[model samples]
Every structure is written in C-alpha cells, then in structure tokens.
Target: MRRRLLDIIHRFYLDAISRLPPAEFRRTTGLARGLHVGGHCFGPLHPVHNIVVNSIWYAAAFPVRRPAGSDDEDEANALLSTDGIARICHRSLDGLVAALRDLCPSLSNGDALWRLFSTSADLTAAVALANGVSKSINYLSKVLVPSSPHEPSVSPLMLSAQVLDCIASQKQQFKGIGNQVVNVVNMALQQYTQRSGEQLKLHSVCGASLLMEEGLENCYHINFLAYHEGSGSAVGAPVLFFTEAIILSCYETDIRLCVPVDPVTDIGCCFACESNRKMVVHPCYDEYLGGLEFQEDEVDYGSDFPSPLDVDYIFFDADRDSAFANYLWRDSTDH
Candidate 1:
C-alpha cells in the first residue's frame, strides 16, 4: 500500500502538479498553494484551509470499493471509506498542528480545531466535484441506524431519509461550531449516496459471512495511502490512504467518524468482515435500520464488529476460488 501510494505521490502527483496546464495553474494557483507556500498578492485570505481542502478534492476521485484478492489492490478508486479517511485526517491533523505550532507560533491553543473546520469546507467542495452522491450517503451513515445481523428491516432509502431529517433539521450540538464543514460534509455525503445508493450499498446486498477470523491476522496486510492524517490499528499493516475522505478536529476532544462498508460477494445477502475499536461503532445494514425503527440515536453495540471478507479479485472465465489464484497470480504484486 505504501509503495504504490508513495509512487503515486512522488510520480503521478508531483509530476502532474509541476506539469499542470499554465492556464489552470493561474486559475487554481490560490487554491493549490495558499499561505502554506506563501502566495503573492490577491491570494486566498487563508492558505492552510485551502491546502487541506484541495487534498480532499483530489480524494473524491478515489472512492472506496471491494478489495480484489491477490489480483492487486491498485487501480481501485476507494483510497479510503468515509470513516477510514476521516480517521486518517484526524491523525494527520494532529501531526500538522503539532509540527506547525512551533513554526507558526501566532495561532495559540484551540487554533488547530478552527483550522480543521476551514479545511473541511475545502474537502466538501472537492467531494461535490466528484462522487457527490456517495459522499452524501457516507455522511448520512453516522446518524442512521442499521438493522441487526439477522433482520430485514426498513429499506436503506427510508432509513436514509430519516437520518437526513435528523441532520438537516437538528438542534444537535457541534452543529453550529464547525458549521461550514459539518453542513457541507453532510450535504455532499447525503447527495452522493442518494444518487448511487444501489452501488454504494453493495455490502448490504452481499451478505457474506466471516471465513477466517484470528487465523487470518498477520497472514495478509493492507496499505492505504492518501493526504489526510489518521488514527487506527491498521496496526502498521500497510493500510495506506486511510484518510482519502476525511476532516479532523482533534483526537481526545474530536475525532473523525468512519463507516467501512464492503460489498458482499454477489452470491449472498450479507457482508463479510467488519472490525472496529472500542470507541468506534461498527454498524450493520440491519442494525442501522433497527436504530431508526426504535428512534435510538445514542445506542451502542458492544465490541463485535465483523471483519471484511476477501473478494475474488481474479474473476477470469471461471467462478471458483482456484480461478482467483489463476488470474490474480498472473505477473502482479498486491499493491
């Protein structure tokens, strides 16, 4: 994960930016490189916000998707799920604030929190330009309640609407503090999902059961590379790009929320793996529905989030597990 990500960072990214169209360079100059690099006259009033925002903008192009097995993890758009990236950003945000304090000096305590707000707004714009609907849905998952593991409850659409109502017309706390970031993140995620709820809800449809539990640990590793900072136990397992879609406030007082949804293998009506930490929530399609059914907003499910199931990344001309190895093993390394 780190290798491919670093390659993209050093090669695909830098090469592209340095060779940007002259016109685009002039037009987006203020946006691409703001106060961080110290802009010229008429530059954006705030560069820190824009720089983080732009990273999110680029991230929208990379949506989270089912990880294809040995076939390779590259060429997949999902750099991070909404929750995944947010976690990353939370971490990165802290790192930036820590590194910046000694250097910027003027901004005192609580300043980092404010910067997160400004950066979040920029990310909102980026999400709008790309997968507007999925992003919207992603944001909505936070408030919506999924049904339990074994029940067929309210339709995702209906559940989503209720969740939206809670968010859109709420007197909820923190609603006004980071107003710009909160509203836009909510808007972009809601719209993104509404438009492509079908594809976005793939995991709910798959219904695959967990295959390898503790046995699979350390057997494989993942890497998620992206621009946002993060906090998690990818456990140094090469899970790069975990913050592809995130906004951060702070760790103890504030943290990014994420929902890592995986598509079920087309043959079932379930999801495979779902893992989460003590503080995070690991909701299922059913549990989310149940929450809405009972009007429960602050309910908590114990530490039992299932892990993700590996997909047949190498679906060539057959439909067997061996077929995965046959095709996926054709001259490639898992990115």
Candidate 2:
C-alpha cells in the first residue's frame, strides 16, 4: 500500500505539475517542502495517556474524500482528515494573509477566509489533480493497506490532542469573529517597528469546522469515547481504511465533546497501521449537525453519543438562566 500510495502521489504530481504553466509550479513546489517521498510520510506521533481530555477533534465526510470513483472509499465508505479546514487554513494562512493584505485587504473582513480560499484557485486545482490520480491508481492497483503484508492492518489515526486543544481554546476562531482589538492595536504597533512579523491568532482570525451549530448548545471542549451501544459483541467495521481523521465542533455553551474511538487506534491500537494516506472530504462541512444549532439554553456534549438509558446533553459549565436540555444526534444509519 505504501508503494502504491507513493506511486499515486508521484503520478498526481507528475500529471498536475506536468501541465502547470511554470509560475504555478514554483508556488506549489513549497507545499511538498521536506515532505519525504521515500521515507515515512506521517509526522511525528504523540501519545496521550488520559482519554478524558484529548486533543483530537474532527468530523468526516467519506464521499467527498473518496469521490465517486475513488478506491479508498471502496475499502471503506468514509472520508476523513486528521486536521480540519481550520487547521489547513492556518497552515496555508501565509498565502491567505497575502491574499488579504496584498491582494484585497480592503475587502470586508467577513469575506476574508472565503476570498483567500477562492484566490488560491491554483492550489485547489493542484489538490484535485493529485486526488484524481490517487483515485485512479487505487482502482488500478491492489495495494497492501496494512503497514506490512503479513499484518492485518488498522487505519491510521487522524487529528492529535494538541490540535483539538488548540481549537477548543480559540474562542475567536470558533465563530469567525475577528478581533477588533488586535486590528486596532496592530495599527498602532506599525508606527516604530522596522520589520514586524504579522501574527495570527487562530481564533480571532479564522472560522473553523465550517459546519454551523446554530440552535444547539455551543460548548468549547470535546471528547471521544469507545463503546458498543449494546449492538452485541461486534466489530465496528468489517474493514476500515483512511488517511486522516476529522474534527468538527458545533453548538454548545459549555461541554466536553465525546467520540467513539475505533478500537484499533485506541485500546486496540496494537492492530496494524495502514500504509497509504487518503484524501479526506468532510462535506456540508460548514453545516450544523442534526439541524441542532446553539441555543440560549443548557449546553450538552454527552448527547452526541447515545446510551440505552437515555440521550441527554453533557454540560461541563453552564449558567442556570436557561433550563431544559435535550438533543438528538443524527447518525449514519438514521437515514
């Protein structure tokens, strides 16, 4: 699988860069910077002890990641990314800041993120080319997904605890609410500095998880749990494969988000590691889940997961002004 994955990535690059008009190639070349094509592509791994407070935060859209003809999806019907658009936006922020400050800073701050994303049309095109080639190769080849051919592999885990912690702490980015305070202060700082580095406050500068949690209880923390909802002693999926894990946060005043960890990655991590990386697609990316938006009431997180006892929202912190807390999370099988 690793060989096949590399092959696909190589093909994608060749196909996309092959057609580039020179200037565009120079710009994209940087994305692959220090990205070892031969060696391990996964970044350094960090182990977290307590699952109660974790950093992984992501929601996935499998169809988009796999696309109609994509192969990874055939192995499993899910699209995933360890990092969310917000994280990607942060990494790509240098370009976005340029688009804003240099290309069209005068544009309403409200449109900043969108405009920046649109301006980088070339980058998206490049990603499409790479993704397309990956899909083609997946269909053409029978690659070993397990880290080793002899080992029955498990999928790679996406999103880390630190990343999720970062999102939870960033209040400004939570709502796409720009910091008026910083804009005013930065203007004054420009007076005497010879060379100033433009800093980005993740929350104050960007909107993340794209999905809206309008009427639901909006909270700041999230958690992932692994347990079968009394479905009998069973396997989560017959076979699972993925490149990235996704985190999505929406609705809640104060609560800890809980998620079910695939056993292989959690207590079951001893399972084999998948070699191929995947293109994760989280669609309706910006929409709220279950049509439940943040409301002026009690907050909840536990509700995201179901229990035979009863489904109730989890609240870590809350003001008693509002009463009554209840929610229904839409699951994949609901449809």
Please provide, for model 2 over 1-335, each residue's C-alpha lDDT reduced to its tens digit, 9 standing for 90 to 100: 22332343333333433332443213212212111111111111111110001111111111124347654412221222223322332333434334334433355544544432332322232222334442224422322342455865554434334433433444434234323323322332232122334221112211112222343322111111122222344334322211111223322122112122233343211001101011112122232132323342333323333332111222312233122111111221243
TM-score versus the correct structure, for each prediction: 0.16, 0.14
82 in model 1: Cα distance from truth in Å? 2.2
Off by over 4 Å in 2: 1-89, 117-335
lDDT (Cα atoms) of all candidates against the true structure = 0.30, 0.26
Candidate 1 residues 115-223, lDDT tens each? 4343442222222223324333443353266546886454322223333333334334334433433333333334444654512211111121211334332111111
| lDDT of model number 1 | 0.30
Cα error, residue 145 of model 1, in Å, equals: 52
Best TM-score among the predictions, by candidate number = 1
Per-residue error for 149 in candidate 1, Å, reads: 66
